[model samples]
Target chain A: MQDIKEILWEICKAPGSPGQEGAARQAVKAVLEKVCPQAVLNDDPMGNLTAFLGDKHSQNQLLFDAHLDQIGMVVTGITEEGFLHLAPCGGVDRRVLPGSPVDVYGKERLTGIVCCQPPHLSDGKAEKVEPVEEMYVDLGLSRAQAEEMVRPGDAVLLHVEPRQMLGARVTAAGLDNRAGVAVLLRCAQLLGGKPLSCGVTFLFSSREEIGCEGARVAAYQVQPSQAVVVDVSFARQPGVPPQKSGSMGAGMMIGTAPSLDACVTSRLIALCKEHGWDYQMEVMGGRTGTNADVIGITRAGVPTGLISVPLRYMHTTAETIDCKDAEYTAQLLAAYVQEKGGALDG
Target chain B: MADLKLLEELCSLYGVSGNEGPVRQKLCDLLTPFADRIETDALGNLLVYKQGKQRPKTRLMISAHMDEVGLIVTHITDDGLLKFATVGGIDNRILCGKQVMVNGHYGVIGGKPVHLMKGEEREKAVAVDDLSIDIGAMNRAQAEQAVSLGDTVGFVSGFDRFGNKVRARALDDRAGCAIVAGLVQSELAYDMTFVFCVQEEIGLRGARVAAYQVQPQAAIVVECTTAADLSGVGAGKQVCRLGEGPVVPFMDRSTIYDREYYELAFRLARENGLLCQTKQRIAGGNDAGAIHVSRGGVRTVSVSVPCRYLHSPMGMIAQEDFDAAQTLTALLAEHIAGHPAV
Candidate 1:
């Protein structure tokens, strides 16, 4: 309802590669400032930004977190043919790299194509995807010219424009997480005038794609009584099994884990049902693989829950999500914040 | 008297698997001054106790295993070579042509020189049976003087501190022991029982008995975990990193952590500003496998120092991570003492 596609477009376009997330941080900060002026914003040593809302004297603190960083690449070397050798900032599936166009962020923005030898040139084993080290990006210039435009340590983001597909499905690069960031922003906007009984800290963490490092620091710093980590879960797609993945456009996914606090989970499920929101449940036998992992064991430990937005083709260009599902996730969170105060404290 | 020097000395001592007398003695000597009561279990586990200010409703158990994976002498040849078998899980690939000391004795693991192997054989890992200990002795009698059948030998290595990290053999559990040692030296509010467990390399045999003896209501297993944060591994698969902080296992293959206790730790960490990360992958089991099920099932949580190349010689760990775990454990102990919830 709030031009969610446009918000997703702006966020998905920002170049934020793991440890270098300043640009994305600024972009998200601008949106958050406009929505929640009374919110307390703080950045920890690890570059995780948290915006606190509601009354500070509230007995319960509910932490809502979504990472602001996206998976990209770092320039490692320049080939003699003007190709840029790049190292992955996060887990970049090598099979997706060869034909992908990327926006290289250096002194100035440069466009490059990630390229490798074609099947006809090498042994049939060339079909077997090689490591990122064996791949390079071509910028269509001589080595000297390419070197003048880009240097080592430049960031490279996948080049893809956000597109609104049929109905509410949206497609773009980095939608695996920027959708989550967009949800946090939307939730903060909705909570502006609502009288809340609990203190809510909305964390726009950095470097979650690399490791849950930013959330780790922020969790230890905020030390909230309860935490809910909103992240992207693998969605059911062409090759993916529905048993292991959630369906896209099927609302939000709630995680059940051996690590997840059972009380928090039960309360969240009840809240979702009470508010008549579409939600699915995911059972994680071991690790939830989100900021919940760290937030669950920060100082002593904090009871944490995970809410996932189903995503297709994660950690790749053209990551896709359902806008309706994103909106329902934010609505569920806003409703949960209003209802979670008594249950969490008691 | 020197904690760092003692750590180096303890690390350098050779006592692998079944033959851990030298390491046990070193720990006993170091723990003697700090512990109010000290006793060794039948399985060679060092149980050190420090009484609290009041009658403890909960006995806090802290454990670190002493046994490290090494080689055991299976047969001694008439011509001074010793055939051995692995005492624990060892990647035989890294075993060929490495320096080793036999149960505080001078010896070296000997294997065929690279020049002697030909063609496809060079590509294959050297078999354990193809390796032996060479003490530069001519006959069985000379070999008997320095080594014997069933003699245990480990990588004779000293702890080396570099930048912010430390590399050594047996830091996996030795670092845990040093943390327990540090705790014993501090003024604790709870009745603390630190178990320097043995035979853990052989499937947590000592911790089972030690847990039975202490029967703590809550336990914190401070040990080392595998740090696979390196090149070539996917970011999602890098398990943990060095210097990031202590790797706390929310759920591992062995135990599902208590949710309340887990939250208690996270809350305290956030309050104290400690650096910590949750274990992202279900990989290995630890003493928590037994500690969680001890007696009526004690509530257990594990805080591990992330170490690279576990179960091998030259395990690397971040020193700050070890310290963070120590601080968190100490803080946890104090918290439990201040608030009796159980």
Candidate 2:
């Protein structure tokens, strides 16, 4: 568990923005090599990495995927007062950005604070919130010094660290996906001696925060018969519909979509029941908005299933998740892979 | 004549939006010689197949729409001019004074002369209702002889080369049809399905049905896109330039391309020394709108020829760009056919 926590810590701290996911790629690659030493690590032109486990001659192939990239910042311009104008690499809530601390990674590292006009400087009453365009980051440096440390196109990440909340709950930045990646790593480590009936491939994908770009390439290259995309789903948060949100410590959530093959979902459900694991159902009306949407359409079409870890405040600097839920997800995946022999019936 | 002679023959065939029998028959004739099996779907999409020696490791579907922008005659005026509505996204501004062929019959558009217009009316572009087709008919009886109500009409023009560029009507997709035709003439290693789809000008109706039926592992759409590289347009909004080779879209409004497929295309373009540009802006939809969502889903990519004044009677495109698109598509087909699913 401590090793898994360290892996998560390292991954969340890495800076990888959309279209510029090399840093996260290197971090994920280092961890993947440590767990699956014999696994082949190859990156497609899209920067998607596929790590293969077990023998190639295995009759069936199962692929598990988790996107490596996280939401961050790209410096679009710099103001004269050492403030930085930034564009979101992925979707970011502009309202929460003000007063948040960020680490700008350009030619060198620099810490900055997101600032807006103080109420005293504004007209007696203005719009309560400003658009992201009007916002800027103050690095507490002179214009010349800030310009020397950071330039346009440099990446920046939230200056937040992982902290254990209420015993089982953990709060961190980028738990939206790095937690899923940690689950895959832990699953790989747990299933070492247990003989697998089929070949398994683990993919720590890149560029998913922007779009499912990495999953698109990994699925095409692997062309697996069966695919499982592990990502984070929104949990029960304040003002969120109770029915729609998955419970935080209630266990793993299985996605149900018209695009998701019924047989795959049922098989996963049956596996969870067989293993006596706590599980819940999530209904996806149209698109799953995960890698499952991409993997389901690859080539002749692959039957895909999704296992989600419940997280609150997704796509934010202070995203929160329960560590037990992540472990349960890993356990569910390991059980499904080990007991996936019978003909899949919807 | 070069292979373009075949292309010209294809372009000359009349296949307006709803009625595409003439174009379908012509494509069938041209594809029969090169295909192992040729068939048509319920929506009139032409599917031509060439089997490979190996049990097809991958099923590749290459598509180009056969339908061109035209007008469907809705009413005939008492003065013998034909009142029509456009079947696709037609620039109403270009409708006046343009010559159109009604279902292969020659005609000229008749509308109010510029001198007869009132204040502010002259500044505004002509609407569809104000324009009508004149086929030298004195009455409705005489107008029925040359064309009829509900008859489809399109620009009656031929391709002409000026320097390295080619100007023509309906190049919005006839150029795409020609590229697919060129690929069919080449040797392919993987089992290939060439679809000359119909009704693409309207809403990609034919592509939707074709993708549902073929259920291909991967698809590549050959298309002609709007080239806004004119003098007035700014650099950021200049969608494409003529003779800049084929343009591959990274993200279009309709679909975001599969990253692996997009990377594979870029790598292939680099290795072959072919000139290709990525669509920087996400605008316009194509057959990919249907191809990306068909069945479970397909890894899809689009290669387009940059054309000026798309959806107008006189669209212009560079022949070199068309040729470049054809060469790259053929090369990709060969590479995928020989290699594994990756």
Candidate 3:
């Protein structure tokens, strides 16, 4: 087995916060290229990198997608006390800002902590937990020192390292879709040296944390007969309700949503059962909350199926997943591309 | 001092709603020695059962939430500032200029200084959208190295006593947790279930599962209700007053306490020579709101220590009110155990 932890560390450690995905794109691109050297690689205008494998003219074309970007913030202004004011680029939560460690990305990398005036200085006048707009990042620098280092447009991200936890779980800040990307790479690696009847497009999408822009662009360009979108789903834990999510280390989540192609989804679930693989059902009454939603509707509508690894702490620094789940998702994807029939289930 | 120390530790521990591992562990360690049977539910509700002096068909559940309101990291900016959202209900006003800790690192919440705000901005409170948590990372990668999206952060406030009042973050429920702990030290007349629930700040999350599983005939929810008896606030709207006594609210948004249990508490308080008071206003709700409706319904009442600035990092409470609430809750549990109305 490939050292999945090492692969995830390289992918997640890249600073790929929404629009700022250069490092992540470059890093994941290297992995894709290494895994499928014979595959034709291309990048769309939306920064969706695709590796084309197998025979392109085959009537059946399968596109596999994993978004590369994660949630982050944008620096909007600077305070006289050397603190930087920020705005959220995504679904930012304010309750977790106090004393958080961050870096001001600009001309220089300066380490700092998120702080405000202490209680002694506020005279009991501070309002209840302020919204994100009222928070700031203290660089531990003088006003002059801060202005010299940090630019207003720079981005900040969770300062965390990935770790191998007990029970074969891996945790980090940006494991949401990185876990998906890892699965995609593993599938490509599996199919690299094989002759296949169907074409496979492995897409590492960007700007997914904000929206499914990359997947949309790739879906339109690839114009495939079928697609499988991989992402992260809430894992059952202490606070989350059991019925609402799947347990981490249990199995992969096969999504059933209005936006997903029901036929393709059922076929995937049937495949899992036939193979005796660990799988769970996720019925999203509305949005599937992944790139599949946009890809399912792209260019005359492609049949899209969704697969998500059960992830704990979805958008938090401690986002976690079971390595076995990632490997299982890869095996399914690899088998999916190789299978041929008039219909996916057939 | 010893009792106050426990309250301080509970409030200081970072047990944000949905992330109550620390508080749960502490309570589990504390309760293991005395509890006859203890188990943690899927949602992290710690259920500790103690067989009373006499066996009874009806079981009494005493619940106090272990989770507190905090923030979760949503975005880390390129300039290394953190953007966040409140995990529970928090007024935008109390967020400016506060110290906090994420994971274990410390930072501050900063916004525009009053000196810099112009025109309309100065007239109103700053919108949360404009705030940022500066953790002193030099760049996006540097920040990402320490913090991660969705990492839970807590206020840096610690439990402290000044004069006759105690101030701390999470006193709203930590005070209640302390009360439950105090009750555990006393003898029970009937079998009792002590449930410390989670995610109450977001909703009555953990208590729902606990109530259904225990299915107690009667439940007494120990909580810390809002005490807005500050100067300039109207008397009718004060809701509750610190230093008076524990507030026994007749009704709140989530529930109306069992009429029989409501009247029983006051009668027992009088007989026991305890000073008990009714909440001046029907306002905030607690786990009782959920417990009363769980599994075909459980009879429930809420007894809260009056807390000022309920959701902020620094909530204030009267030490006397804390003591009184502890005494009253313990008494109510013993009463429910002895006199089974179920």
Please tell me how candidate 3 rates in CAPRI terms: incorrect
Which digits, one per residue and each the tens of the lDDT, describe model 2 over residues B37-124?
A: 9998888899988875565666788999988888889887764568899998765644544456775555655433222345555444
Candidate 1, residues A283-342, lDDT tens digits: the string is: 889888788898899999898889999876666554667788888888888887877553
Number of the candidate with higher TM-score, 1 or 2 = 1
Which residues of candidate 3, in runs, are more than 4 Å off? Answer: A116-127, A341-345, B1-342
| Tens digit per residue, CA lDDT, model 2, A35-90 | 66666778778877777766567767888999877877788888765568888777
What TM-score would chain B receive for each of the candidates shown? Answer: 0.94, 0.95, 0.97
Candidate 1 residue A183 Cα shift, in angstroms, is 76
When candidate 2 is compared with the true two-chain complex, its DockQ is: 0.01
Worst 10 residues of 2 chain A by lDDT: A118-127
What are the runs in model 1 whose C-alpha is more than 4 Å off?
A1-346, B1-3
* DockQ for each model: 0.01, 0.01, 0.03
Rank all candidate structures by their TM-score, best first, as comma-separated numbers. Answer: 3, 1, 2
What's the lDDT for all of these models? Answer: 0.75, 0.74, 0.77
